[model samples]
Target: MQLGGDETRRLADFLAASGSGSVPSDTGGYIVMPTKGSPADVIRALQDLTATDRMDALAMLLREASEKPAILGDLVSRLAADERFIEKAAAAMNLAVYRQVLFRLETMIDDPTVKEGQFQALLEEQPWLFGSEYSCILDRRRWTRDEITDFVPRRTTDGRVELIEIKTPLHGKSLFNWDASHKVWAPGVELSRVVAQAENYLEKLDRNRDGILANDREDVTKMRARIIIGRDRDDDQRDALRRHNGHLHRIEIITFDGLLAIAKRVLRYFEDAPAEQCVVLGT
Candidate 1:
């Protein structure tokens, strides 16, 4: 891979460090070279580099470990013995991956081909982005086949189920619009449709709550739903969403931008976490 300026400096530093202990010029036809060094020095060197470089090095190491299963197993066994290290490492990876997800979403938000399926898949894979209160997404049931709606249900940490509906901002309709007749912003046709569909899902699920409780072993009592869709064109529309959403009981609407803001806050918590050694690469 082509090295950037920062990476070039890192390479230079590495070369200078290993430049010592050269082979003799007249020591037979060939000589063995030293390929190992101090693990502490390696850790220090990695720490001196940027986080990106450290992650790249980690990716390489993981790939190498995958090829050598014994070492990988032993390494995991040792690392898993420390609960604190696991917590710190998990936090770091979560922050890194969330940043990446935010970047991907921001870059692809306007792409025409990327639709509900893409966003649904992304949110499902990273349910923590919704918040730590959520534990895991529930499996889609066959009952929703009749409605053909994309309702993502997640179990809360306390075992209550939450229905989440996601839509691409490419919905081609404003979520909140000025009601020229009423002289205030109100939910547009499309947004109202999604909310109604979510309520419908909730109603159906409520009716089948007992079935879900017995069969799926999930609690659906006093369930709440969140609708993720649309975009705010300006401050007025955003404020309007807040006003309208406040009127709803258990259902809420959140634009993608709002979701992004929420994700940023989650990231900030990690950014504020106590510094720890890089568990993956030994920073």
Candidate 2:
């Protein structure tokens, strides 16, 4: 069946809304065209629609295709045939997945008893949250035969090699405690301890830099360290982090909430553009 003007418009609205992480009111109302014969036939038709670059039609197609596993498989196969369509579809899918992850992270960050391993898992799964320009090269990666750091990392694009240490959000009080007597914020005990740990990791890497590069095939001479822990207590805490981070030339510290914010920003980058259409149209 050919998509009518109203259907096309609705699909556009849906695509726009989904890109922004909002569910359109009429998502469930869109109709999926029935397959003519085999799943391949349906995909061929969808490929035709994607040529138009109408993101709405593609959104509708994906929604409908999701209900038919066989057809979905066909759709996946066809993704390779069109670079533009595949890129758009991939971005849309990534944004959706990361948004769900962000929601779960919000809950996890609030739980004071959450373990450092859990946070490490999240970062490993979604490396973009760490930084737009960072990717996970190693997790619980061994520096020596017996010495493992929480993460051995790489630049997402191109930059200095880095080391990362994560601590449980529950391990710290506020990242910074209000020192009312001096009317200034000071790094909390947990934050200080983690920072020290990161520093130690950096030193270890430096001492074994040549060995690590030979083993991992990654340069570590300019490696820096980052410690992720706790949550910001207030604006004062954030200001404290800025001041504290400024002095530390080699190691940077960030709170759990700060990490979450970075993740959300990454999601926004993908959602800013309307995805290209991928709906299959009639014969």
Candidate 3:
């Protein structure tokens, strides 16, 4: 589960050299390449890979290695634990591949003969459900003025001055225009319906205010509402969430497909992020 500094450096070097812009040549047990960059550069380079690119590269790498059965286990194990390699490997490995890997790793962990650290290592390599840094103000029946300021935020980080609202229909419906009278979208789910949820969250944050978004200088006062109608749901959801669109408000009313796509991204982040940063709110 843990790599020594030297090994980490070497692994980082391997990842950076194997990246898209560099050439990688297998040199016996360890890969060899010529580059003036440090190991940190390689780690950063690996992180720079787009999720799509990493997934593609990992598939090709695994497929090619599958032809050589002798080194398959070592290759796969190294790829799984290497920080520089994991994101790409997770992306590259298909759902079936991931399932198989998790099953085998779980079996290893369940064995009483294995050490606790070994079990932890297996967990580090595999994870369950994935999701984004979800943030919401839960509405409760009881509250006080003093208790309001002491409320814990739902997001991963603080000082978030924007709320992004997304509106999408259940199916692939089009939003040609907004029905001003009903305050809903035409032929699809209305922007107001989705914004209503955001508004509720805002209201929970500031119960006594007349409007959800108050013109405050300190706390978050502005929100940029987005309506993703007829948009490609799956992978597009993650992209839509990440690209905040130059505005502050960044919430999404995504279809199940879109939610699934971003769910993976959130999972990937959960797997790779630091322990302290991974604190669960309700837990």
Give the winner by lDDT. 2
Clash count for candidate 1 is 0
Flag regions of model 3 displaced more than 4 Å: 1-153, 159-169, 175-189, 200-255, 269-283
lDDT by residue (176-265, candidate 1, tens digit) is 777899898888888888888878877777788788778877665577778888888689978989898888878988888887778777
Candidate 1: which stretches are off by over 4 Å? 1-59, 62-94, 140-157, 217-221, 275-283
lDDT of each: 0.66, 0.69, 0.44
Error in Å for residue 276 of model 2: 6.5
Tens-digit lDDT string for candidate 3 (38-87) = 76876776676555535565656767776887777777667545645545
The TM-score obtained by model 2 is 0.64
Candidate ordering by TM-score (highest first):
2, 1, 3
Models 1 onward score TM values of 0.62, 0.64, 0.28
Most accurate candidate by TM-score = 2
Please write out the lDDT profile of model 2 over residues 1-283, one tens digit for every residue: 8999998997897688679865555646543332445657656755755544345536655776877766876675565455355456555555666678889888888877777789888877767677567644654476655456777777767755677788877544677788889998888778888787777766777788788788877666677887778777677878888999999978888788788888788667656745532112110
Per-candidate RMSD vs. true structure?
11.9, 12.3, 16.7
